[model samples]
Target: MKIVAVFNYLLSFLIAYWNTESVAEDEFIYGQFPSYFRWGIGTSSYQVEGAWNLDGKGENIWDNFTHSTPSPIKDGSTGDFACDSYHKYEEDSKLVKSIGVDFYRFSISWSRILPLGTKEKVNQAGIDYYNNLINSLIHHEITPVISIHHWDLPMPLQNKGGWTNEEMIEHFGDFARILYANFGDRVKQWFTFNEAWVICVMGYGDGIFAPGVKEITETPYTCIHTILKAHAQAYRIYDLEFRDEQQGQVGITIDSGWLEPSDPNKLEDIEASERALQFKFGMFASPIVFGKYPDIVRKSVDERSKQEGRSTSRLPSFDKYWTDYIKGSYDFIGLNHYSSYLVTSASSDPGPGWYGDQNAVTFQDPSWPETGSTWLRPVPWGFRKVLNWIKNTFNNPPLIVTENGYSDLPDVGLNDYGRIEYYKGYINNLLKAVIIDGCNVRGYSAWSLMDNFEWASGYTERFGLHWVNFTDPSRERIPKESVKYLRKVFLSNGFPKPTLPWNSIQLNEQCAAVALDPDTSF
Candidate 1:
């Protein structure tokens, strides 16, 4: 018996060694996310499915927005011919399966589905494109999680006042109903909006992203109101008309980044940071979960509205029925987490007051991770903390981590150990949030399956675990070491056993066996 115990111990040590053996400079994150977690990758229409204005598709807001003024995006770049996944999704899916992922989270371009963004006339060609895409995924045994919209509103809608129009609620619902009728059978999951904060602030208020309009007071606030109403309308439509029949869940994707103070002991800085979060993630989450906007947002904005002599709240209010209608519309919360920052109250300076009249404090973390992008720095602990904050604050809503990844400089090399390290750190923190802190995390999809247009930053930031040769006409795909590494993990059912041939396909069998046995814990 003693010898058997000793033998088991020996195997454990061997497994650990093999897993970490010659691992590059990054991979040492500690903690676990959750057991039975789903793993996959992500991409969006404009960024990847670049069939812009192709195949009888009608022009959406992005097409018009980008074409009219391309300078607002980071590199004056547009998604005219992104990764060309619109034509080459088969090749893209091959890369996904090669990594042995079980799911693929992507968005259906509104313009692609309803060229004019209406239910009155469905675009059969657009519908066929997604039908084939969904069918291809299922053929490869991959689950498809679809986002209904990812910030690319149709140009016609904008001309009609876009989110500024209360009628958008019905318009968006019409769109959702059409999506449900066609794709509901195969695509069981859906996200209504990608990130309201960025869509409102960067896209409209700051004129940074597509549909670039700038620094307009009350416009961003009004957009949020219309957006919330639209989300509620679409969600109610799905629940009342399609959920039971289709057997699917629907939700909205909220962009959340952790806020910290440059000096933890400074009361003003801490207050400002918390307020920053309220403005960003809370503006969305609080409404759905707690049945109202963040108290601070309501209070501050009301005063601002009053000071500006607005007769009502800058934050819109729904009738009690609509409040309830919007409050519990989500089945789960889709989160996009990339990094955290330290925000301090603006000290009487003249920067546009974003999160309440505040000060500038650069985003800092003593030992955060870095991606290829200059604006983003990774903070794994921030992820765990953010999850816990959401879990506790929102009464533990089920969660699907829709997008989390490290964007490094393009051509960082095929063996991007930096990315591998980023995954380890974030995934570990995710597990800690789930197991240790009790956040209800169900799945994780890395930011991208393959790098594409990357929006304003253009094609410069590569977030894919698998690299794409954008310059190559064929747009060849190459698996970075992360593809193999994450495959080892997913195949292991968590972390690969530290044993010989750590990257071996045999580990997948072991993982399948363990997953089936129901006795494994990560």
Candidate 2:
């Protein structure tokens, strides 16, 4: 018995060594990534799927929000006819194949599948539409990564208070069951929600996004609680009912801008950075992973609620039953990181919003490169910092970078050296996180396959490998110079050794034709 135990221990050590040999030998000095690492791009249904009311499609909150308020969306435009991907998805699939990616991540519109957000009747047309899209992806040898919900709730559900209501738990579960029943055989990776923070805070607290409400304290908490429960329910349903047969993984995508202390030497600044993360990504992530809100978050929110004369904490509390249900609910954690912000302790509260709750002031360094959106500034090193944060906080859960890309200003032609540089910096750091720091990072996906509706910013901010011509009725998709660079990186499975400068690779003729003057900045 003693000799057998020694042999088994030796075998275990050898297996561990062999598993990490690639990382151990390379030391992440070069960007040579694990050959199995994936490179893909994504698009949300509402953002890219036009034909809003076509083919028995029901309305979503975005459809109502945009059409109801004439100027709610930026540029006074709506996603009603945004990219027309509903009709042009074959072209989109061809574009995905052109990029030579392993997978394509996309969301299904809730209303498209269940017009009234219920299982009373499933729309065959909606099922047919997604079947066509999924089939095309499989045919091209591109795996389909599907997000169950990406903030486009059916308008009928919005009428019943949407994510703020507990009924959404079962409603969303039914939606998940339908998806699993239909697509689970081919779809191995399932994301329950794209960014629960954005869905809860932006939609309810700020009133800047869909189903805009602006209730701030109570509504944001309530909405997020509902979303968390819904997510857990869907995960449990999949784990119990479908996971065995489908052999798939289910998780949720949580997004946040990396927060750094403005003055790292000061405890107040450091605490502010921690609080910023707690309020943003940790709000949704903690419940699903750790089974409750962070201790700091619970204490802060309860104290504030008491001071505000509330009978209960403003942040919702999960019962023991729900807590256990949500704990260990995810197979992986999806991170959609874009930029980093310097956070400082706030002297004055901003008032009545998610930012107000954190009591922190955030600003971008002027030295950072600005993108189309004022809020976005590339800080490549922050990628590894945030990844390490997740590693330590979640005890090194498998992570997929579900979204990361640089956005260029509209009308900027395809000489996207800036975006190429952005990708190189972030992806290089991601490789370091995986190889050097030992973060169980599995995959990386660019923000989008092509430019489409960019939420409230509309089409003004372009974050696509392919430049989409929104003005053209046909919505021509043009591959940017960055696409070529990205393809080479995907083919190499990492940054090529002896990295080339952004401008080192000559642009193809199609990209060169649209290049700005030699003196112009990218």
* Local distance difference test scores for all models: 0.75, 0.84
- How accurate locally is residue 408 in candidate 1, as Cα lDDT from 0 to 100? 75
lDDT of 2 by residue, 143-176 (tens): 9999999999999999999999899999999999
Model 2, poorest ten-residue lDDT window? 513-522
Q: What is the lDDT of residue 360 in candidate 1?
A: 45
**Tens-place lDDT digits, model 1, residues 1-522:** 546534543343343223333332233333334467888888998888777888767777777766763265666667878888989988777777887888998888888777777776677888998998899999888999888888888887888877777888888999888888998999888899999878788877877676777855667887887888888888888889988889999898998877766676665665566567778888888888877888666766777668777798666766898788778878999999988887777766443235443334546665665568877887776676677667655678999999998887555877687777677667766765665556788888888888778776787788887778877877777877777667766765565333336456886666444322323433
Candidate 2: where is the Cα deviation over 4 Å?
Answer: 1-29, 351-353, 498-522
What is the Cα-based lDDT of residue 114 in candidate 1? 78
Best by TM-score: 2
